[model samples]
Target: MRRADRLFQIVQYLRGGRLVTAHMLAERLEVSDRTIYRDIADLQSTGVPIDGEAGVGYILREGFDLPPLMFTRDEIVALVAGARMVRAYGGPAMARAAEEALVKISAVLPDTERARIDRTEIHMPLWVVSEEERRTIDTLERAVEARHVLKIDYRDEAGASSCRDIRPLGLWFWGKVWTVVGWCELRGDFRAFRIDRIASITCDGRVFKHERGKQLADFYRQMERDEAARDWAHRRSQNAP
Candidate 1:
């Protein structure tokens, strides 16, 4: 987590006049107690009204609040709708983060905007994504961020099963389906594997560095070229007829 986000979380935990210990904060933020102490000191130095010592618990005094966030109605609707979609279709950790983001956004917004958020009619059905697929997506997402190599047992559309070692590049969501775009060591090219079709996936404890042709940008370029070729072929067929 970024320092700024950690500090914000500290303040959020300290709200409602609740006393939160540095150890507790450390555990929650996955940081050391000393780090939490320093963060608290820094927050206090910034005139954040956080009152507490090293060992004792810290509390945000009553009436303390973050500045109201400004958002137009359309922007608010978009934000709320997107968050709701993620909460329904995203991974477990992502869902929790989305919920917390909604809470934080609501906390900083003016009452009118906050009410608009509640009134936003957009929602997503949670049943569309299976729990297993959600977990796979979360794992693939982490691997993409960390540049980890993964071994996956994948079943293609033709029902052939194969295990491939892949350098995870990125995840693409096609409305109802989720696919991981990766550099396939077996095929020596980019392959998009559907998350639901992956029977098993495990990290190989090895990381990969970005290569010229094996990157996500290269995959996108290849896709564009393929699309253009298809369009050209269709145009030629129409002209021939």
Candidate 2:
């Protein structure tokens, strides 16, 4: 990294509320302890308030923020790339937020830097979930966050339809799609519902008793194991001589 880029990185790292030691910064930036100390001094000269104690390492002054120019070329490229990727695949709210953030970032930078970013566009393929499914997933997310029970009309893979009152524990994303992991009042068990398969949803306006020790990751793992077992059995039956 160039000296100026490394210096900016030092300031950004400190502004993130980390107690950075000379040795740690040296290893991270692939520089010597002397170089780290010099960069620290340069940042201090540029009005970055950094505090260092004997044993506790170095910290930036509370509320000390990095200047907009701190972003290196590569850092700006990465930010633009990530923002573009999110805008392409994420939901409407996320796409709009990423667009707003990119706009603000460009508005703050110099015209030259802004032109450089504009010239180097990053592109990614967009996800193709239906608008109806996207709206259903959005509604379920709100209900989960608000701790509200949901009354939903859902259909299963076997074409069985059911009306369910569920206390949503969390939303799980699997295979690039969304599902609701919740306690089903009708079945009296925890169930996972594909948001796309939901025919209708009504917020009951009653908060749920959150499940104990239930994590979305754990539920996904269990679902994966079950699917694997089913696939294995099907293969075994097909291969029987």
Candidate 3:
């Protein structure tokens, strides 16, 4: 990876709570410690809020945000690769978001860099599926980002349809599908709706608040427990025969 790209990765890694060492960055970016140090200097010179000590690991300043501009070549590669993966496996909204993000990235890049991004190839096959599920994922993602309420028309595996008003907590991408985990007003409980099974969605134009990460974690744990119980019951029923 280039020095500029390595610097961007370091910034993101630090933002994600990783304690990055010069040696570690060296290994990860296929460069020497000296090169890593130079890259760090470049970042610091360019106004990135990276901090570190002699023996302790480096970190980004608390609440430090990535600049709205500036992306390195390797960083572009990673973004393209990830976006392509999302386009392949994520729901329609995510794929569209990936495309939009790439466009934004290109807009921010310098002319030469923008041309390079356009020419770079990171290929991935997308799912050949109908787009009926697209709008729900799009609205759910907006709700998650903006902390808004969504009116949902959903169906379960049994094909029972129900209308619900929900305060979306977050979105989940698992098992090649998108799920919205939210506080459902109809059920008076936190619920997860499969994006593909959602028949319709409308934003209520009202925002709600909850512990975002904690709520998602709790929902995932409950889902795991429910799945486990079903597996155990299936085994017991099979043995009873």
TM-score of model 3 relative to the true fold?
A: 0.50
TM-score (C-alpha) between model 1 and the true structure: 0.77
- Expressed as tens digits, the lDDT of each residue in 1-241 for candidate 3 is 5556677777766786567888887787788888778877788888888888535678888887764666787987888888887777666777888889889787767776777776678886655334665555666777788888788788899999999998888877775677778878898778878888888888758877675544666777878999999999999999995
Distance from true location, Cα of 109 in model 1, Å: 1.5
Each model's backbone clash number? 0, 0, 0
User: Which candidate comes out best when scored by TM-score?
Assistant: 1
Assess candidate 2 and give its lDDT.
0.78
Tell me each candidate's TM-score. 0.77, 0.54, 0.50
**Which residue pairs overlap in candidate 3's backbone?**
none
Residue pairs in candidate 1 whose N, alpha carbon or C atoms collide under 3 angstroms: none
Query: Which candidate number maximizes lDDT?
Result: 1
Compose the digit string of candidate 2's lDDT tens values, residues 191-218.
9898878999988588876555344555
Off by over 4 Å in 2: 1-66, 69-82, 109-122, 125-127, 211-241
Winner on TM-score (1 vs 3): 1
The lowest-lDDT stretch of 10 consecutive residues in candidate 2 is: 209-218
